[model samples]
Target: MSRSFIIDGSIIYTNYSQIIGQSKFEELLREFVDILKEKQSPLLNALNAFKVNSDYDVHRFTEYLHLLTMRNIKEIGNIIYYVNPKDLERFIEAFYTFWRSKHRFMVRNEKYAEDYNRRASIEYTVTMIGDQFKATIKNLYRELMMNVSNTFPTVMRQLPSGAQVMFLIQEPNGEKYRKNEWVTKIPTVWGAIFDPPAIFYTKSNKRRGILPVVEKDILSEIALDPNEWYRFAIYVGDLLMYNFVHVEYLAHGAGLANLFELATPKDLESREPDGILIFGLPADKIPGYNEKWRNGVIFKEEDGYTGVIPAFDENDYFGYMKKTTLTIHNLIKIDRGKLPIHGSMARITLKSGKSVVAMFVGDSGAGKSETLDALNRLEEVAQIDTIIDDMGSLDIIDGHVVAFGTETGAFVRLDDLPPGFAYSTMDRSIFMNPDQINARVIVPFNNYNEVITPTHIDFFLYANNYTEVHNDEERIVFFKNPNEALKVFSEGKRMSKGTTSETGLTNSYFANPFGAIQRKEEHHRIAEHFIKKMFETGVKIGEIRTMLGVQGYEKEGTMLAARALLKVIEQI
Candidate 1:
């Protein structure tokens, strides 16, 4: 009546007649009995080898046999046609393979042993202690002193609109630091932590940059320290719209504070943070840092707020820091049912004094910023004001679609810009890993009001940076149908320009993963409503192929795209 089995130390019972028909159940039982009589000794040996302590493992084996029998009966003639000595041996081997694959501890242990041996084989030898050695030791001591100074509590006492930020250091031997989950998973490397890299960009010379890690993994990897001393409070955005980030860990707090506007401790204590970011412990401390899912960055949407946790070191701080802000903004925007587009937006005033606000939606390295920056420099476009450089939101305001910027500063790629542009903003810019190909700079180029204020959008365009256009007419294609326009906008298609790990051509829905991807239904509803309204209001919709992403055609493609954009503007 009832069949019982053990799996992973747990007992599971099933009613054979209820699960499989009575006839099939009897047929399987008969087959299993015959097999036991013939191969009982070998099967028992195999079970013992697998450490099967209970009867459930046997039942599980019978279940597998039943399924296999059923499959053979349906495919071939009858149960007698398939169940034999040869097939039974094959089945046993297949089951062993499946079990071994699932139980991978043995494999992992061997891998760990290999890695330990490899690391142990490396040699580090010291020669005679000459003048050079003495000087090297002295330089090391000086560098240690500099790190000590830089490791002190960094406080930003004042921020615009009464926001402040502070980074308090945690004691090395504190109970909170030692007892955290992340600490337990990963061993702490104090020397590596104390002497972190000065730059955060990737070292790759290729045009495509490092791929961004998933946000959820980054958040889940964090293990918060109980001590409040390791915490920091910062205010970001502006008074009209702003959010507070109460983060744990000095490096993450410092990285974020440097990237965005800071807020005061008092403001954070009084106001609920729009998002919370926790950097639990360093990546080196995590046990399985090399695993695919454990890249140490994660984001989660909670009740009334969003949260982000990133496991990043000093060398990758710039990229992760930017991601933290973008992730938070995206979560908030999606929660509020607003569309957050990954692109650059600007308000351009033509020579005729007609001002039009446009949003160039695309992934990174899609020429969104470059095209906007080039247009800003053109004499025909006399005045150009940036709303947001990286990420922003689109919403309906006063019955008209309006665009709002998210940050006061722009985190721009150095390789994309013309020579001398980075130097011009050096006074206000924070350059990161300048020697690397995908180096970055954060500069306060746009006003806070310009970033936060809602500007009426007159044009919506996709920056087609990688597509090949045969003629000038093909460079820009206007969408006459709203469905066609929505399709293009939703597809978010573009060629990879090495800003991320993706190669060749890739596409994202709405060219936005943060906001649009999170709330698909809401994004669709908002986008459809906006697109229909734009058509009715005479707002232009089209694509501009900059060809900046293509190799060997970067300059020529950009020029051609720019000229085409200029022509489109002239008609407007």
Candidate 2:
């Protein structure tokens, strides 16, 4: 308490005057004032979060003055910090003086000491944030090696354009680098980074149980924590829902907002939500359901809305946040007579203006993304615009099976990508556990308008990542009929590439475990209808042998399959 700063977990908040002087805040305001007068950017707009006296000519710096005192400031590592620019001699001195002493206290903890003994996985800072922030702001990052542990979380999490967080520099300064601004959040950091005993997430043990009809409100009896409740209204292909997430898992939950369209306030206010998903809640918070799911998630139809709750964070993986959100989306699709697909889709165009909308359906590690990436690289393929990267839905519109995309971004495996692929989009990507196997990069590739628009399927092909086709023509084999297509698709088989918990050969119903597997009966009825509609509508159905999971094939197999696809599209 004598330190004049409130320390909660990894976050610290104190009076502005404690670290930064009044002159620094004013100097900061002047720079942003200049930027607003000359240029505009999504980042520069963080200042716009503060209201302006619209009628005033050169109104006093009253807003900035109030900000200097007002609490609830926020920080995103050095990428975005609230006050006291990282390079300011004051900040460097203040932080070093404080954490240096605290390090002694923290090292006293046996577990902290043990973990510190292990390598800190410094590679994250090297590739992702080391060059990212320090190079941009003031270029003093590497010199500040001691701060890596606390800085990593803030730099890696990408915020949506208008999140309450603000951009520094467009607003503040550290003498010569006086153009820097820092975001500061005033609220208490409650349960923000508490590492509870969580299950290691593996695809194998995570079971799914669906309750067709739940008669009562499961949450009615428990006392819910209000501060922990945060809402993310996202559109998974227009199936809009309010996802209420627990603050502990909120960062990962917010990842869903990055991929899917975060529903606008206008829509959220006007339209009724199609579903309500509550993620990261303790089983005790929802008493009635724990008896059913000892470890896995529970998908149930409650009062006309679908719900999915992952009872535990066993694996501490991003997949929990992603898959649970998809499950809610898919279940809603199942109820609305649509088929939720776990696959990749794109719109490829040739030089002659000929366009083909191709869909490669498969489970995780079946080359849904890798094959499509390879397809984009083909010389003859003039342009390939991705429509859906991971999850999508098939609906019968005007008696044809039309597909709608569920995500604008992709949660792509680093190893599956072609050389220099992930780095190509480094600026827009967020890397998760980069030093470990099954590392991934979450990058927003397409816009919401592109993915949400209903597009007809030109080719509905199953991704055969396991098989190698030597002959060009043999790379893509057409299904004899709808039954054959249904048989191959429903019996979703693929060689696991260690991207998931499963190893070697595996089978998932329809290559989709999200909601399709949870509500198989309903999904089957819907799948049959859509596949039949595809055949009736003359949508080319077949299997593209990517050979991505096949030994010695890898990138070559995908390129070969892509070549075959180009020829097939031209022939069609």
- Reference-based lDDT, each prediction: 0.53, 0.58
Best-matching candidate per TM-score: 2
Q: What are the per-residue Cα lDDT tens digits for candidate 2 across 83-188?
A: 3333232333333333222111000001111133231332222223322321222222222322322333335322111111110001111112111111011111
Backbone clashes, each candidate: 22, 24
Tens digit of lDDT per residue, candidate 1, span 498-543?
Answer: 6666788898788776546756787798788878878887888898
> What TM-score goes with each of the models?
0.58, 0.66
What local lDDT does model 2 show for residue 369? 82
The alpha-carbon deviation from the true structure for residue 249 of candidate 2, after best TM-score superposition, in angstroms, is 2.0
